[model samples]
Target: MFGFGIPELLIIGAIVMLIFGVGKLPELGSSFGKAISNFRKAADGKDMIELNSKKDG
Candidate 1:
């Protein structure tokens, strides 16, 4: 709730909707969700990193 009332939350939601628009809002939300997911996965050591080493002739 963050101490916000119905009216205050409505105002904030309206502003966010206006700024992002209904069409792109879902995409933004999905992207945010993915970023959070990836961060969590990395923290849990689930992310993979590849490194290549070259042999000297």
Candidate 2:
């Protein structure tokens, strides 16, 4: 992803550490996970709008 190799990945990780700090890694990871989950649900048309429409009819 993003055409990164080992060296590039390490550099990107270092930048993230600088930006977000080690103490916030878990919070960032969890929020990223939730965003990814929501993106997948949206792509599959399984989000709240779809559920509500199904219920109304």
Candidate 3:
């Protein structure tokens, strides 16, 4: 998995925290989760586009 071990992940996490700050981490995590969910739905051909349009209308 891209050869990322615990030390590498901790370094990456520290970088992200420095950039986004602790206060916004929760918001960022939520948005990231939603993006992943949408990506999975799209990969499964779930017609997300139509569903979003229907909700808006």
Model 3 — which ten-residue stretch has the worst lDDT? 47-56
* Winner of 1 and 2 under lDDT: 1
Best by TM-score: 2
Question: How far off is residue 24 in model 3, in Å?
Answer: 0.8
Worst 10-residue lDDT window, candidate 2? 48-57
Residue-by-residue lDDT tens digits, candidate 3, 1-57: 899999999999999999999999999999999999988999998845553444554
Candidate lDDT values, in order:
0.93, 0.91, 0.92
For candidate 1, the per-residue lDDT at 36 reads: 100
lDDT computed for candidate 1: 0.93
The runs of at least 3 residues in candidate 3 whose Cα sits more than 4 Å from the true structure, single-residue gaps closed, are 48-57
Tens digit of per-residue lDDT, candidate 1, span 1-57: 689999999898899999989899889999999999999999998897888999999
Descending-TM-score candidate ranking: 2, 3, 1
